[model samples]
Target: MIAMTALAGPPADTLWATSLRRWNALCWVLFAMMAVGLATMDGPAGSRYTALALLGSVVLCYAVLDRFPDNPAIRPHVYLSVLAVALGGLAYLRSNYAALFMVTLPHYWMFGRTPRASMGFLGLATVGTVAGSVLRQDGWTVEFFSETVVSTLIVVAVGVLIGLWAHSVVAQSTERARLIVELEQTQAQLSEAHQRQGAADERERLAREIHDTLAQGFASIIVLAEAARAGLDSDTARSAQQLRSIESTARENLAEARELVGSAHRPGQTAAGSVARTLRRTLNRFTEDTGLTVDAELTDLVCDQQTRIALLRCTQESLANVRKHARASTVGVVLTRQAHGVELEITDDGTGFVVEESTGFGLDGMRKRLAELGGRLTVTSSVGDGTRVLALIPMAFEAPGEGEAER
Candidate 1:
């Protein structure tokens, strides 16, 4: 029953609604054409007889058309019955030419929306034609029987072809619609994946900035303060006072770094006043006391608080490495926005070493910090060649609940 229903196509209710409208229009047109043909035809049996017969067939066809909208199988049987009556009436009138129209009636009737039902109608029509011709002739000669059989076969074949073509068209249309729906679903999934990937990237960048800047600076202040406390009894009282001042300043900077880091972790925190400006102030203070040429080129690039902190830390780490290892002339810091990300270049004409052979914690820590933020750090240096450290962080990375901000 399920297979049978599937073969019929769609639900019976929908098919009924669609087929009824079409059949109603077709029936009316068929009735009008038949009525005109009957009126004009002059017959020995009389025009009244032909008119009554065509009118009766028209009435029957209309009744069937109206009734079988909910049942497609019944429609073809109704059409076949009407054609049989018309063919029989024409044969009685000795109008063989008009009776030939009966052969083509099944062709149209059998090729309605349902192809399986139409094929059944085609078989019925073929049998009825052959049987009617034999019964009317009284004596079936080979010549007459062969002609009727051949004509019936031709009509059936044509109806079958029409039914197959209609089925093909409907199948193609259904498949195209299904494919379009699938394509739309796939596009939606891809868009969602891209959004998620962008968010993950941003979170990592924030993590890297925090580790490099605030964390490393606090460690340095702790070490320096302990040294000053231990050496206060010696003649290094001036150095102890200087170290005490450095400790106080480091504590102040630590408070600022904590606030910035908190804002980066928390969503919806306004980043208007907390950006490169704060970092620049800290760097300026460090340069003033140390007399280090901190050639800083910081931009007004707007980023999340966490990302800002990460970038600041990255800068601090690079500078710390410069102060510790790169003992040379001028040091240059360049921070610039790229097409898809940001780049920070720290160059110094210091005594360079083999990057592969060195197992320093500072460089390794820097690399690890950048990786968390979906960024990369590359160190380019050789013996006596000016050391250049380049860090690249993609703008695509965003923390959860945070969106990309313009630079």
Candidate 2:
């Protein structure tokens, strides 16, 4: 006849509250059956009626407390006190009623707010039941001692052990729930951090693309337009030639802009040919635009598309720097296939500045691009001397798609 209480674990949800309600219903059924049996049993009329009144009072108190669980005025300890008193009075009326004391054990554990409080109420209930039964016999008797006192002590000892075990189970369940919540929160934060890092990498890539392609084309157009205007009063044919060059540069710039925005082939992807032919075409264009003497030795090499693109970009950036600041007349480009990989070297006999002091974005961009391809760039120059830009790339580098899939 042990009663059950609300399980102390995670916060009560709809399912948990529903289960608790069902348990309360079962307790009510047991109490109702006990009341009916007591009414039918034969006994002294006065004692029977008094015991019935006490049972009715206990039922009323339990019902009120259960209905208003959160009411500050109706406390659990008050209901336990009334229950203990009724159990003792019933046991005194008829020694047979001492059996009901066993059924009362769980009520103390269920209603008491703490372990110490529950133990206190349990002890009080046991003493009350045993004392009343002993007094009803009017003297010390072995039958009363064996049935009432000994059995009550055994029940109390077993109930204490069960209560302690239930408390430990609830404690472990609560701790596990707390750890699960913390783990979910940590995973969410890691996901957000990864997204932020991805966005930043994308922005850096776009900035480098704009600097290498569209920015250089626009510079070419500006220079060509100014040259055409200057030569118009002196030579009409040459002025017309310069104007055509401007138009050609403007058109190339437009195509580069569309590719960057449309997410189609990137800027260097449109340059169709081997790495050698690509550098040859770029050198020819530089000579045409700047009228600088160019000595080029290129080797037709086999490599990945990204390697070709990186070499082309490095060549373009080096020539741009020479055109803007080198003030050199002869530009030399040499592309050779080594044992490990391909190498591209561009040297200009121009007035160069100290490499360490230069903070231009073009050089930094080239270094970052080559590094991404498992390559490196080395620039050697000094004041009044020419600058040499060399780029080296590994041949065994993974393709972009293959590398991503493996990860």
The TM-scores of all predictions, comma-separated, are 0.46, 0.77
- lDDT scores in order: 0.62, 0.81
Task: Identify the runs in model 1 with alpha carbons over 4 angstroms from their true place.
Answer: 1-158, 217-280, 285-314, 323-345, 349-351, 355-379, 383-386, 390-407
Error of 2 at 276 (Å): 2.4
Q: Which stretches in model 2 have alpha-carbon errors above 4 Å?
A: 1-8, 11-20, 39-145, 264-273, 397-407
Candidate 2 overall Cα lDDT vs. reference? 0.81
For this target, which candidate reaches the highest TM-score against the unseen true structure? 2
Task: Summarize candidate 1's per-residue lDDT along 1-407 as a digit string, tens digits.
Answer: 11121222343488775665566556556645765565566655575566566556756675676566577566555665566555545444443533454434434433344666666655654565566566667777988756766766775676566557656756776786688789888888888888888787566555544555555666657646665667777749755665865777688667757865676567666363334575677567556434567677766566765457556666677677666677866777776777778777888888887989978666776777768679889999998987888988887434343222323
